[model samples]
Target: MDIANQAALVTGGASGLGAATARRLAAAGANVAILDRDAAQAKRMAGEIDGLAYACDVADAASAEQAVAQAAAAQGPARILVNCAGIGPAARIVGREGPMPLADFEAVIRINLIGTFNLLRLAAAAMIATEPQGPDGERGVIINTASVAAYEGQIGQAAYAASKGGIVALTIQAARELAARGVRVMTIAPGIMATPMLLGLPEQVQQSLGDSVPFPKRLGHPQEYADLVVSILTNPLLNGETIRLDGALRMPPR
Candidate 1:
Protein backbone atom coordinates (compact mmCIF):
# COMPACT_ATOMS: atom_id res chain seq x y z
CA MET A 1 0.00 0.00 0.00
CA ASP A 2 1.11 3.55 -0.52
CA ILE A 3 2.67 4.65 2.79
CA ALA A 4 2.30 8.36 2.15
CA ASN A 5 0.07 10.13 4.66
CA GLN A 6 -1.02 6.85 6.21
CA ALA A 7 -0.83 6.37 9.95
CA ALA A 8 1.76 3.84 11.03
CA LEU A 9 2.29 2.28 14.46
CA VAL A 10 5.58 0.72 15.56
CA THR A 11 6.11 -1.04 18.87
CA GLY A 12 9.55 -0.88 20.57
CA GLY A 13 10.15 2.19 18.48
CA ALA A 14 12.51 3.78 20.99
CA SER A 15 15.54 1.99 19.66
CA GLY A 16 16.95 -0.63 17.31
CA LEU A 17 14.83 -2.07 14.51
CA GLY A 18 11.58 -0.39 15.55
CA ALA A 19 13.28 2.98 15.73
CA ALA A 20 14.67 2.54 12.26
CA THR A 21 11.25 1.56 10.93
CA ALA A 22 9.60 4.62 12.49
CA ARG A 23 12.14 6.93 10.89
CA ARG A 24 11.79 5.28 7.52
CA LEU A 25 8.01 5.37 7.60
CA ALA A 26 8.05 9.02 8.57
CA ALA A 27 10.44 9.74 5.73
CA ALA A 28 8.05 7.96 3.40
CA GLY A 29 5.29 10.41 4.39
CA ALA A 30 3.54 8.26 6.95
CA ASN A 31 2.35 9.79 10.21
CA VAL A 32 4.15 7.53 12.66
CA ALA A 33 3.56 6.62 16.29
CA ILE A 34 6.17 5.14 18.61
CA LEU A 35 4.96 2.86 21.42
CA ASP A 36 7.52 1.62 23.88
CA ARG A 37 8.09 0.73 27.52
CA ASP A 38 10.78 3.42 27.69
CA ALA A 39 8.68 6.51 27.81
CA ALA A 40 11.59 8.93 27.68
CA GLN A 41 13.26 7.23 24.77
CA ALA A 42 10.01 6.87 22.92
CA LYS A 43 9.35 10.58 23.27
CA ARG A 44 12.87 11.36 22.16
CA MET A 45 12.55 9.27 19.04
CA ALA A 46 9.13 10.69 18.32
CA GLY A 47 10.52 14.17 18.54
CA GLU A 48 13.20 13.31 16.02
CA ILE A 49 10.59 12.00 13.60
CA ASP A 50 7.78 14.46 14.32
CA GLY A 51 5.66 11.52 15.42
CA LEU A 52 3.49 10.53 18.37
CA ALA A 53 4.85 8.70 21.39
CA TYR A 54 3.12 6.41 23.89
CA ALA A 55 4.48 4.66 26.97
CA CYS A 56 3.45 1.11 26.40
CA ASP A 57 4.25 -2.38 27.63
CA VAL A 58 3.33 -4.50 24.67
CA ALA A 59 2.85 -7.56 26.85
CA ASP A 60 0.06 -5.93 28.83
CA ALA A 61 -3.38 -6.02 27.24
CA ALA A 62 -4.53 -2.83 28.94
CA SER A 63 -1.35 -0.95 28.11
CA ALA A 64 -1.35 -1.95 24.46
CA GLU A 65 -5.08 -1.20 24.10
CA GLN A 66 -4.69 2.24 25.63
CA ALA A 67 -1.68 3.08 23.48
CA VAL A 68 -3.37 1.97 20.28
CA ALA A 69 -6.49 3.95 21.09
CA GLN A 70 -4.45 7.03 21.88
CA ALA A 71 -2.43 6.70 18.67
CA ALA A 72 -5.62 6.37 16.65
CA ALA A 73 -7.06 9.38 18.40
CA ALA A 74 -4.04 11.39 17.35
CA GLN A 75 -3.31 10.05 13.86
CA GLY A 76 -6.36 8.09 12.74
CA PRO A 77 -6.34 4.31 12.66
CA ALA A 78 -2.96 2.93 11.58
CA ARG A 79 -2.68 1.54 8.07
CA ILE A 80 0.58 -0.11 9.05
CA LEU A 81 1.58 -1.90 12.25
CA VAL A 82 5.11 -3.15 12.96
CA ASN A 83 5.63 -5.34 16.01
CA CYS A 84 9.23 -5.11 17.26
CA ALA A 85 8.85 -5.42 21.01
CA GLY A 86 10.59 -8.52 22.41
CA ILE A 87 13.18 -9.90 24.87
CA GLY A 88 16.16 -12.19 24.24
CA PRO A 89 17.58 -13.28 27.57
CA ALA A 90 19.44 -16.53 27.14
CA ALA A 91 19.09 -19.43 29.55
CA ARG A 92 19.28 -23.21 29.33
CA ILE A 93 16.12 -25.17 30.01
CA VAL A 94 18.06 -27.38 32.44
CA GLY A 95 21.23 -25.69 33.54
CA ARG A 96 23.43 -25.97 36.61
CA GLU A 97 20.84 -23.82 38.29
CA GLY A 98 18.46 -26.71 37.62
CA PRO A 99 15.67 -26.28 35.10
CA MET A 100 15.44 -22.67 34.05
CA PRO A 101 12.88 -20.78 36.07
CA LEU A 102 9.44 -21.21 34.57
CA ALA A 103 9.04 -17.50 35.06
CA ASP A 104 11.96 -16.92 32.72
CA PHE A 105 10.33 -18.84 29.93
CA GLU A 106 6.98 -17.20 30.57
CA ALA A 107 8.54 -13.76 30.50
CA VAL A 108 10.02 -14.28 27.05
CA ILE A 109 6.82 -15.72 25.66
CA ARG A 110 4.71 -12.99 27.19
CA ILE A 111 6.77 -10.12 25.90
CA ASN A 112 7.48 -11.55 22.45
CA LEU A 113 4.62 -13.78 21.31
CA ILE A 114 1.66 -12.52 23.34
CA GLY A 115 2.86 -8.95 23.00
CA THR A 116 2.94 -9.25 19.21
CA PHE A 117 -0.54 -10.72 19.15
CA ASN A 118 -1.88 -7.95 21.37
CA LEU A 119 -1.00 -5.11 19.00
CA LEU A 120 -1.78 -7.18 15.91
CA ARG A 121 -5.34 -7.84 16.99
CA LEU A 122 -5.99 -4.22 17.94
CA ALA A 123 -4.48 -2.78 14.75
CA ALA A 124 -6.22 -5.35 12.56
CA ALA A 125 -9.60 -4.46 14.02
CA ALA A 126 -9.02 -0.82 13.23
CA MET A 127 -7.77 -1.68 9.75
CA ILE A 128 -10.85 -3.73 9.03
CA ALA A 129 -12.99 -0.75 9.87
CA THR A 130 -11.14 1.50 7.45
CA GLU A 131 -12.22 1.78 3.81
CA PRO A 132 -10.23 -0.53 1.62
CA GLN A 133 -7.64 1.15 -0.59
CA GLY A 134 -6.55 0.22 -4.13
CA PRO A 135 -7.92 -2.47 -6.42
CA ASP A 136 -6.65 -5.29 -4.17
CA GLY A 137 -8.95 -4.02 -1.41
CA GLU A 138 -5.95 -3.51 0.87
CA ARG A 139 -6.73 -2.32 4.40
CA GLY A 140 -3.36 -2.51 6.18
CA VAL A 141 -0.22 -4.53 6.66
CA ILE A 142 1.31 -6.04 9.81
CA ILE A 143 5.02 -6.85 10.04
CA ASN A 144 6.40 -8.91 12.91
CA THR A 145 10.03 -9.43 13.94
CA ALA A 146 11.32 -12.87 14.72
CA SER A 147 14.86 -14.31 15.13
CA VAL A 148 17.03 -16.80 13.27
CA ALA A 149 17.17 -18.84 16.46
CA ALA A 150 13.57 -19.78 15.90
CA TYR A 151 14.75 -22.17 13.21
CA GLU A 152 18.14 -23.17 14.65
CA GLY A 153 18.15 -22.35 18.31
CA GLN A 154 21.56 -22.58 19.91
CA ILE A 155 22.36 -23.71 23.43
CA GLY A 156 21.08 -21.34 26.16
CA GLN A 157 18.40 -19.83 23.94
CA ALA A 158 15.42 -22.01 24.80
CA ALA A 159 13.11 -19.24 25.92
CA TYR A 160 14.09 -16.75 23.26
CA ALA A 161 13.90 -19.32 20.48
CA ALA A 162 10.52 -20.65 21.54
CA SER A 163 8.98 -17.20 21.61
CA LYS A 164 10.32 -16.38 18.15
CA GLY A 165 9.28 -19.75 16.84
CA GLY A 166 5.74 -18.99 17.89
CA ILE A 167 5.87 -15.76 15.90
CA VAL A 168 7.14 -17.56 12.80
CA ALA A 169 4.32 -20.05 13.13
CA LEU A 170 1.73 -17.27 13.49
CA THR A 171 2.68 -15.49 10.25
CA ILE A 172 0.83 -17.56 7.67
CA GLN A 173 -2.09 -18.35 9.93
CA ALA A 174 -2.70 -14.70 10.65
CA ALA A 175 -2.26 -13.66 7.02
CA ARG A 176 -4.66 -16.33 5.78
CA GLU A 177 -7.26 -15.39 8.39
CA LEU A 178 -6.91 -11.67 7.78
CA ALA A 179 -6.74 -11.96 3.98
CA ALA A 180 -10.46 -11.62 3.48
CA ARG A 181 -10.36 -8.44 5.57
CA GLY A 182 -7.69 -6.93 3.33
CA VAL A 183 -5.07 -6.96 6.08
CA ARG A 184 -1.74 -8.66 5.35
CA VAL A 185 0.48 -10.42 7.88
CA MET A 186 4.16 -11.24 7.48
CA THR A 187 7.22 -11.95 9.65
CA ILE A 188 10.94 -11.24 9.31
CA ALA A 189 13.30 -13.66 11.03
CA PRO A 190 16.52 -11.73 11.28
CA GLY A 191 19.95 -13.17 11.82
CA ILE A 192 22.44 -11.63 14.23
CA MET A 193 22.13 -7.92 13.79
CA ALA A 194 23.74 -4.85 15.34
CA THR A 195 20.88 -4.37 17.75
CA PRO A 196 21.80 -2.80 21.09
CA MET A 197 21.54 -6.17 22.80
CA LEU A 198 24.08 -7.73 20.47
CA LEU A 199 26.27 -4.65 20.25
CA GLY A 200 26.88 -4.68 23.99
CA LEU A 201 28.96 -7.80 23.85
CA PRO A 202 32.77 -7.81 23.83
CA GLU A 203 34.38 -6.59 20.61
CA GLN A 204 35.83 -9.94 19.67
CA VAL A 205 32.54 -11.66 20.32
CA GLN A 206 30.83 -9.19 18.04
CA GLN A 207 33.42 -9.76 15.36
CA SER A 208 33.03 -13.50 15.72
CA LEU A 209 29.31 -13.22 15.26
CA GLY A 210 29.74 -11.09 12.15
CA ASP A 211 32.25 -13.43 10.62
CA SER A 212 29.81 -16.29 10.95
CA VAL A 213 27.45 -14.93 8.32
CA PRO A 214 27.91 -16.76 5.01
CA PHE A 215 28.03 -13.60 2.90
CA PRO A 216 28.76 -9.94 3.42
CA LYS A 217 30.34 -11.41 6.59
CA ARG A 218 28.82 -8.88 8.93
CA LEU A 219 25.85 -8.10 11.07
CA GLY A 220 22.57 -7.13 9.42
CA HIS A 221 21.51 -3.53 9.62
CA PRO A 222 18.23 -2.34 11.10
CA GLN A 223 17.79 -0.14 8.05
CA GLU A 224 17.92 -3.23 5.85
CA TYR A 225 15.10 -4.73 7.90
CA ALA A 226 13.15 -1.52 7.47
CA ASP A 227 13.81 -1.70 3.76
CA LEU A 228 12.32 -5.17 3.64
CA VAL A 229 9.27 -3.87 5.48
CA VAL A 230 8.86 -1.29 2.77
CA SER A 231 9.19 -3.96 0.13
CA ILE A 232 6.56 -6.09 1.81
CA LEU A 233 4.11 -3.22 2.20
CA THR A 234 4.35 -2.03 -1.40
CA ASN A 235 4.36 -5.43 -3.00
CA PRO A 236 0.77 -6.62 -3.06
CA LEU A 237 1.77 -10.21 -3.70
CA LEU A 238 3.84 -10.57 -0.53
CA ASN A 239 1.63 -12.05 2.18
CA GLY A 240 1.45 -14.77 4.84
CA GLU A 241 5.19 -15.32 4.60
CA THR A 242 8.21 -15.36 6.89
CA ILE A 243 11.26 -13.99 5.12
CA ARG A 244 14.66 -14.64 6.63
CA LEU A 245 16.83 -11.57 6.71
CA ASP A 246 19.89 -13.69 7.27
CA GLY A 247 22.89 -13.53 4.94
CA ALA A 248 22.40 -17.08 3.81
CA LEU A 249 23.52 -18.19 7.22
CA ARG A 250 22.01 -21.29 8.72
CA MET A 251 23.27 -21.20 12.28
CA PRO A 252 25.08 -24.12 13.83
CA PRO A 253 23.95 -25.51 17.17
CA ARG A 254 26.15 -24.11 19.89
Candidate 2:
Protein backbone atom coordinates (compact mmCIF):
# COMPACT_ATOMS: atom_id res chain seq x y z
CA MET A 1 0.00 0.00 0.00
CA ASP A 2 1.13 3.49 -0.80
CA ILE A 3 1.83 5.66 2.24
CA ALA A 4 2.03 8.82 0.21
CA ASN A 5 -0.78 11.19 1.21
CA GLN A 6 -2.23 8.66 3.64
CA ALA A 7 -3.05 9.61 7.21
CA ALA A 8 -0.92 8.07 9.98
CA LEU A 9 -1.00 8.26 13.78
CA VAL A 10 1.90 7.41 16.11
CA THR A 11 1.45 7.27 19.86
CA GLY A 12 4.37 8.31 22.14
CA GLY A 13 5.66 10.40 19.29
CA ALA A 14 7.41 12.89 21.55
CA SER A 15 10.67 10.92 21.81
CA GLY A 16 12.46 7.63 21.14
CA LEU A 17 11.22 5.09 18.63
CA GLY A 18 7.82 6.69 18.20
CA ALA A 19 9.34 10.03 17.26
CA ALA A 20 11.63 8.39 14.73
CA THR A 21 8.72 6.53 13.18
CA ALA A 22 6.70 9.76 12.96
CA ARG A 23 9.51 11.52 11.13
CA ARG A 24 9.95 8.57 8.80
CA LEU A 25 6.24 8.44 8.00
CA ALA A 26 6.22 12.16 7.28
CA ALA A 27 9.19 11.77 4.95
CA ALA A 28 7.32 9.03 3.17
CA GLY A 29 4.61 11.61 2.34
CA ALA A 30 2.08 10.48 4.98
CA ASN A 31 0.03 13.11 6.72
CA VAL A 32 1.22 12.30 10.23
CA ALA A 33 -0.50 12.90 13.58
CA ILE A 34 1.70 12.55 16.68
CA LEU A 35 0.18 11.70 20.05
CA ASP A 36 2.20 11.96 23.26
CA ARG A 37 1.94 12.94 26.90
CA ASP A 38 4.59 15.62 26.40
CA ALA A 39 2.57 18.26 24.63
CA ALA A 40 5.44 20.71 24.25
CA GLN A 41 7.87 18.27 22.70
CA ALA A 42 5.21 16.69 20.56
CA LYS A 43 4.16 20.11 19.32
CA ARG A 44 7.78 20.92 18.54
CA MET A 45 8.23 17.72 16.54
CA ALA A 46 4.94 18.33 14.81
CA GLY A 47 6.09 21.75 13.73
CA GLU A 48 9.32 20.32 12.40
CA ILE A 49 7.59 17.57 10.46
CA ASP A 50 4.55 19.56 9.35
CA GLY A 51 2.26 17.15 11.18
CA LEU A 52 -0.47 17.41 13.78
CA ALA A 53 0.18 16.69 17.48
CA TYR A 54 -2.18 15.72 20.31
CA ALA A 55 -1.58 15.29 24.00
CA CYS A 56 -2.72 11.78 24.93
CA ASP A 57 -2.50 9.16 27.67
CA VAL A 58 -2.69 5.83 25.94
CA ALA A 59 -3.62 3.93 29.11
CA ASP A 60 -6.92 5.72 29.49
CA ALA A 61 -9.59 4.67 27.06
CA ALA A 62 -11.32 8.05 27.06
CA SER A 63 -8.07 9.93 26.63
CA ALA A 64 -7.04 7.78 23.67
CA GLU A 65 -10.47 7.92 22.11
CA GLN A 66 -10.56 11.69 22.29
CA ALA A 67 -7.04 11.98 20.95
CA VAL A 68 -7.70 9.60 18.07
CA ALA A 69 -10.89 11.46 17.33
CA GLN A 70 -8.92 14.69 17.24
CA ALA A 71 -6.52 13.18 14.74
CA ALA A 72 -9.31 11.93 12.55
CA ALA A 73 -10.93 15.32 12.71
CA ALA A 74 -7.74 16.89 11.44
CA GLN A 75 -6.82 14.30 8.79
CA GLY A 76 -9.60 11.83 8.04
CA PRO A 77 -9.26 8.27 9.41
CA ALA A 78 -5.71 7.15 10.04
CA ARG A 79 -4.61 4.40 7.71
CA ILE A 80 -1.57 3.59 9.84
CA LEU A 81 -1.46 3.42 13.65
CA VAL A 82 1.84 2.79 15.45
CA ASN A 83 1.57 2.12 19.19
CA CYS A 84 4.78 3.26 20.93
CA ALA A 85 3.46 4.83 24.11
CA GLY A 86 4.80 2.67 26.96
CA ILE A 87 6.91 2.65 30.13
CA GLY A 88 9.66 0.24 31.27
CA PRO A 89 10.51 0.61 34.95
CA ALA A 90 12.15 -2.55 36.21
CA ALA A 91 11.30 -4.06 39.58
CA ARG A 92 11.70 -7.52 41.06
CA ILE A 93 8.60 -9.47 42.05
CA VAL A 94 10.18 -9.96 45.44
CA GLY A 95 12.93 -7.59 46.52
CA ARG A 96 15.01 -6.60 49.54
CA GLU A 97 12.16 -4.20 50.30
CA GLY A 98 9.89 -7.29 50.34
CA PRO A 99 7.33 -7.83 47.60
CA MET A 100 7.40 -5.27 44.82
CA PRO A 101 4.64 -2.74 45.15
CA LEU A 102 1.57 -3.97 43.29
CA ALA A 103 1.26 -0.52 41.77
CA ASP A 104 4.62 -0.91 40.08
CA PHE A 105 3.60 -4.05 38.24
CA GLU A 106 0.18 -2.65 37.39
CA ALA A 107 1.66 0.55 36.01
CA VAL A 108 3.86 -1.31 33.56
CA ILE A 109 1.04 -3.54 32.38
CA ARG A 110 -1.42 -0.66 32.17
CA ILE A 111 0.72 1.62 30.07
CA ASN A 112 2.53 -0.94 27.96
CA LEU A 113 -0.16 -3.50 27.18
CA ILE A 114 -3.45 -1.82 27.90
CA GLY A 115 -2.28 1.36 26.28
CA THR A 116 -1.62 -0.39 22.98
CA PHE A 117 -5.07 -1.93 23.10
CA ASN A 118 -6.78 1.41 23.75
CA LEU A 119 -5.49 3.22 20.70
CA LEU A 120 -5.74 0.22 18.40
CA ARG A 121 -9.37 -0.43 19.28
CA LEU A 122 -10.43 3.13 18.60
CA ALA A 123 -8.26 3.51 15.52
CA ALA A 124 -9.45 0.26 14.00
CA ALA A 125 -13.07 1.21 14.60
CA ALA A 126 -12.61 4.30 12.49
CA MET A 127 -10.40 2.55 9.94
CA ILE A 128 -12.84 -0.22 9.18
CA ALA A 129 -14.96 2.40 7.47
CA THR A 130 -12.16 3.64 5.27
CA GLU A 131 -12.41 2.67 1.62
CA PRO A 132 -10.13 -0.20 0.86
CA GLN A 133 -6.86 0.59 -0.90
CA GLY A 134 -4.53 -1.48 -3.06
CA PRO A 135 -5.12 -4.89 -4.61
CA ASP A 136 -5.16 -6.47 -1.14
CA GLY A 137 -8.04 -4.29 0.02
CA GLU A 138 -5.95 -2.87 2.78
CA ARG A 139 -7.82 -0.40 4.95
CA GLY A 140 -5.25 0.09 7.69
CA VAL A 141 -2.17 -1.39 9.35
CA ILE A 142 -1.28 -1.51 13.05
CA ILE A 143 2.29 -1.92 14.26
CA ASN A 144 2.68 -2.64 17.95
CA THR A 145 5.91 -2.28 19.98
CA ALA A 146 7.25 -5.00 22.24
CA SER A 147 10.63 -5.62 23.85
CA VAL A 148 13.18 -8.45 23.84
CA ALA A 149 12.57 -8.62 27.58
CA ALA A 150 9.39 -10.51 26.77
CA TYR A 151 11.52 -13.51 25.84
CA GLU A 152 14.70 -13.31 27.93
CA GLY A 153 13.39 -11.25 30.75
CA GLN A 154 16.17 -10.24 33.12
CA ILE A 155 15.84 -10.52 36.89
CA GLY A 156 13.81 -7.34 37.34
CA GLN A 157 11.79 -7.46 34.15
CA ALA A 158 8.81 -9.51 35.31
CA ALA A 159 6.33 -6.68 34.92
CA TYR A 160 7.76 -5.36 31.66
CA ALA A 161 8.12 -8.80 30.19
CA ALA A 162 4.59 -9.83 31.09
CA SER A 163 3.22 -6.72 29.43
CA LYS A 164 5.28 -7.25 26.27
CA GLY A 165 4.43 -10.93 26.20
CA GLY A 166 0.75 -9.99 26.16
CA ILE A 167 1.43 -7.79 23.13
CA VAL A 168 3.05 -10.71 21.33
CA ALA A 169 0.09 -12.92 22.10
CA LEU A 170 -2.35 -10.34 20.85
CA THR A 171 -0.66 -9.82 17.47
CA ILE A 172 -1.69 -12.99 15.67
CA GLN A 173 -5.18 -13.03 17.16
CA ALA A 174 -5.78 -9.42 16.27
CA ALA A 175 -4.61 -10.09 12.73
CA ARG A 176 -7.00 -12.99 12.46
CA GLU A 177 -9.96 -11.05 13.78
CA LEU A 178 -9.27 -7.97 11.68
CA ALA A 179 -8.40 -9.80 8.48
CA ALA A 180 -11.87 -9.35 7.08
CA ARG A 181 -11.67 -5.63 7.72
CA GLY A 182 -8.52 -5.33 5.66
CA VAL A 183 -6.48 -4.35 8.67
CA ARG A 184 -3.11 -5.95 9.41
CA VAL A 185 -1.66 -6.32 12.90
CA MET A 186 2.05 -6.85 13.56
CA THR A 187 4.60 -6.39 16.34
CA ILE A 188 8.26 -5.47 16.70
CA ALA A 189 10.21 -6.82 19.65
CA PRO A 190 13.31 -4.71 19.82
CA GLY A 191 16.42 -5.79 21.70
CA ILE A 192 18.64 -3.28 23.46
CA MET A 193 18.02 -0.08 21.62
CA ALA A 194 19.77 3.16 22.52
CA THR A 195 16.57 4.87 23.52
CA PRO A 196 16.41 8.00 25.64
CA MET A 197 16.16 5.89 28.78
CA LEU A 198 19.50 4.19 28.13
CA LEU A 199 21.13 7.34 26.74
CA GLY A 200 20.41 9.03 30.07
CA LEU A 201 22.71 6.61 31.84
CA PRO A 202 26.41 7.26 32.43
CA GLU A 203 28.62 7.14 29.33
CA GLN A 204 30.64 4.15 30.56
CA VAL A 205 27.46 2.31 31.51
CA GLN A 206 26.05 2.91 28.03
CA GLN A 207 29.18 1.56 26.38
CA SER A 208 29.16 -1.53 28.59
CA LEU A 209 25.55 -2.18 27.71
CA GLY A 210 26.22 -1.76 24.00
CA ASP A 211 29.09 -4.23 24.18
CA SER A 212 26.61 -6.93 25.18
CA VAL A 213 24.98 -7.15 21.77
CA PRO A 214 26.53 -10.07 19.87
CA PHE A 215 26.93 -9.01 16.25
CA PRO A 216 26.47 -5.24 16.01
CA LYS A 217 28.27 -4.76 19.35
CA ARG A 218 26.17 -1.66 19.81
CA LEU A 219 22.67 -0.62 20.75
CA GLY A 220 20.13 -0.16 17.98
CA HIS A 221 19.73 3.25 16.40
CA PRO A 222 16.25 4.77 16.44
CA GLN A 223 16.51 5.26 12.69
CA GLU A 224 16.99 1.53 12.13
CA TYR A 225 13.74 0.87 13.98
CA ALA A 226 12.07 3.58 11.94
CA ASP A 227 13.31 1.96 8.74
CA LEU A 228 11.62 -1.29 9.69
CA VAL A 229 8.38 0.58 10.28
CA VAL A 230 8.54 1.84 6.72
CA SER A 231 9.11 -1.64 5.40
CA ILE A 232 6.21 -3.17 7.36
CA LEU A 233 3.81 -0.43 6.35
CA THR A 234 4.56 -0.78 2.66
CA ASN A 235 4.69 -4.55 2.53
CA PRO A 236 1.21 -6.03 2.34
CA LEU A 237 2.28 -9.60 3.04
CA LEU A 238 3.73 -8.88 6.49
CA ASN A 239 1.05 -9.41 9.14
CA GLY A 240 0.32 -11.16 12.44
CA GLU A 241 4.05 -11.52 13.15
CA THR A 242 6.43 -10.27 15.80
CA ILE A 243 9.73 -9.31 14.20
CA ARG A 244 12.56 -9.15 16.71
CA LEU A 245 14.59 -6.04 16.09
CA ASP A 246 17.14 -7.24 18.58
CA GLY A 247 20.60 -7.96 17.11
CA ALA A 248 20.62 -11.58 18.28
CA LEU A 249 20.94 -10.37 21.86
CA ARG A 250 19.53 -13.12 24.04
CA MET A 251 19.85 -11.31 27.31
CA PRO A 252 21.50 -12.98 30.28
CA PRO A 253 19.48 -13.34 33.49
CA ARG A 254 20.92 -10.45 35.42
Off by over 4 Å in 2: none
Instruction: Write down the TM-score for model 2.
Output: 0.98
Candidate 1 per-residue C-alpha lDDT over 1-254 given as tens digits, one digit per residue, 9 for 90 to 100: 99999999999999999999999999999999999999999999999999999999999999999999999999999999999988888888899989999999999999999999999999999999999999999999999999999999999999899899999999999999999999999999999889898898999999999999999899999999999999999999999999999999899989
* Collision pairs in model 2: none
Per-candidate TM-scores read 0.99, 0.98
Q: Distance from true position, residue 125, model 2, in Å?
A: 0.7
Which candidate gets the maximum lDDT versus the true structure? 1
lDDT for 108 in candidate 2 is 93
Model 1: how far residue 84 lies from native, Å: 0.5
For each of the candidates, give the backbone clash count. Answer: 0, 0
Per-residue lDDT tens digits of candidate 2, residues 1-254?
Answer: 79999999999998999999999999999999999999999999999999999999999988898999989999999999999988998888999999999999999999999999998899889989999998999999999999998888999999999999999999999999999999999999999888898899999998988899897999999999999999999899999999999788898999
Ten consecutive residues with minimal summed lDDT in candidate 2?
190-199
Candidate-wise lDDT, in order: 0.95, 0.93
